[model samples]
Target: MSRDRTRTRERSGDAGEEFDAEFELDSELDPDADEDRTRADPDDASGGFRSRAAERAGALFAPRIFIAALLVTVGALFATSTFIPLPGAGLAGVFAAAFLFGAVLKDRRYAETVLSGALAAGGSAVLDFAVVALFGGVGLPLVAVAGGLGAVVAAVGTYFGRDLRKGLTQDL
Candidate 1:
């Protein structure tokens, strides 16, 4: 006995989603006029200018330093609160810890990166949860606030720490 074969695929892309399939009929059925199909370039990058810019941004920022910093910040904040008295001083401690870590241990900014991630993730989540309980739902705004704070902390910490190490590296 002969059997027909069919293949089905569910496809999704930046533009949209689709379903495609190929089928084989035994003894080959004649092609139907209604079955006409057109082909489009799968790898086409053509999407106007800003669409292209968005694509580029997604490619660059979606996966790179920003995400890394967030992850690092949140992790660092969680792993250790460190020691600081004032709220402002607490933020300073966070940054200073990262800076000191990047400077002293020469730890390849892993310490700082984790710090940023922790701050972004944990600190933001905590703040949001706390505020929500106190003041009611503020929506997902907390994520943005936390993320922004994390980025600032990570960038400033890494920048100053790296800068501090520049000439000092010569001595060591």
Candidate 2:
């Protein structure tokens, strides 16, 4: 009304009930600008690397991180041992730690970090088994029994320590 410097009025049977229902535009706002800003999927987040990567990121990280940590711990302990001059023992321990960690942490991507390590450890343990067999020190059956015992220990640790068994049934 101030811009126009004029006004109009209407009366509804002298009750002053007439209301102005029309809206006048200021001419500065664009009418069709908003349509361009929206998209069907906006950045198309559901397709390509973003989608799979987002899904796998969490799955891959869990087992690998735990395995790495376990390897570090087992490796440190093996290195600090005074008697065994075999660096291969430390390497084998790292691998066994990886396998134990993988099996315990998550079912997904379990063997990638630990498989090679396990092979090396298996060879070393076999050699140890032969020596123990000849000398009646650490024989094959004894080592096998020890291995079974170690598995039980690891299973219990995974169960009570981090609840890794729960990860197996997690919705992928």
Expressed as tens digits, the lDDT of each residue in 1-172 for candidate 1 is 3546688987776757787888766435534421321113334435344466897666544445445555444444544544433333334545655565456544355533544544554454556378673577653566556555655665577667777887688765
- List the pairs of residues colliding in candidate 2: none
User: Candidate 2: lDDT over CA atoms?
Assistant: 0.47
What's the TM-score of each model vs. the native? 0.40, 0.31
lDDT values, one for every candidate: 0.54, 0.47
What local lDDT score does residue 170 receive in model 2, on the 0 to 100 scale? 68
Scored by lDDT, model 1 comes in at 0.54
- Model 2, C-alpha of 130: deviation from truth (Å): 31
lDDT of 2 by residue, 1-172 (tens): 1121234466778787875554434222544333332233466544544756877876665555645654553454355333456643444344345545545654544333433344333444555557666687656665455444433433443334334445655687
State the TM-score for model 2. 0.31
**Residue runs of model 2 more than 4 Å from their true location after superposition:** 1-43, 46-49, 61-67, 70-77, 80-83, 115-172
